[model samples]
Target: MIAPDPLYPVLETERLRLLCPAAPDFDAMAAYLAPGTRDFVDLPPDPESAWWSVATTIGHWHLRGYGHFAVVDRRSGEHFGLVGPWFPHGWPEPELSWQLLDGAEGRGIATEAARAVLDWLFLEKGWSSCISMIAPGNARSLALVERLGARSEGMFHHRLTGELRIWRHVARTATGRKLMEGFA
Candidate 1:
């Protein structure tokens, strides 16, 4: 087993392991993101963008004291995607986000991982609320946010990413107790 790094908080769910961004994760990220699989954003998957993006996640941790996690399969240890709190140099508040690679979809992986991240952000981190920015045509993300009970707060015009619908989410307090019990 790879020893956990002290710098990153490792969050685990029933079937997933959320860890800090690492070098090996670049392989999974590059495969999915580089092929333009996630066409919602304006990211150019052509060059070595995945490497830079992962680097940026590490930097976000340094600058903001918090960032998203690389979601991994518990049984296989495959690094598949990202989930959790994120706040870049921007016009608005902190956001909770999730993204999964191709085969990882349709398995409720995003939903399960999202709930865990929400608990961490609100109960553990003492956050009062969180937001998720969803692009207009991204149907998958739209549904997941609705399932999480997030409500629409209208569109946010990102300086570079253009217009994205902002969904508001309230803090998970002791109400989240049942969700936190089985973490391993």
Candidate 2:
């Protein structure tokens, strides 16, 4: 029999743990899919849709070597959100994306998690670049992209979510290149 795939690689920041989506994380992740949190993305209304979401996230890891990570609060051991690389069917390109539960915003969690993932992608995976497709009216995400030093590369019509602004991560400078090499 073929050996089953290994689990997702775990990553950690000073205040968070980036893990693969597991069955236990479903409820917390589903909370993020609830009404107010669902605006930018096309999350369905029914609760069961969360199951499909969790399954799809897990499946993405098997289908692609990289996928979104479940963000956990290291101190509280709470599941807070997801952040990482995502490139589903019909996507314009690979994206560094994030979504946090209602109470988790304003804590710099997304930024910390995203930076770690991006660093890994660039240094370990050797990705030359990536983009974040932010919905036009998502001020919070736009701000986060700006904080990450990504520049707006103009907009595109998403097949599922309509129009979205693509923010390309800044190209590495010589110092940044040296840092990535050191990371490797």
Which number leads on lDDT? 2
In the range 78-113, model 1's lDDT, one tens digit per residue, is 756778788987849999988676677789989988
The 0-to-1 C-alpha lDDT of every candidate, in the order given, reads 0.74, 0.75
Candidate 1 segments whose C-alpha is farther than 4 A from its true place: 1-6, 22-47, 176-184
Across 94-146, the per-residue lDDT of candidate 2 in tens digits comes to 89999786677899999999988887787667887889999978888988999
* True-structure RMSD, every candidate: 5.6, 5.7
Error of 2 at 178 (Å): 8.5
Cand. 2 Cα-lDDT: 0.75
TM-score of each: 0.78, 0.78
Q: Give per-residue lDDT, candidate 2, residue 114.
A: 94
Q: Mind sharing the TM-score for model 1? A: 0.78
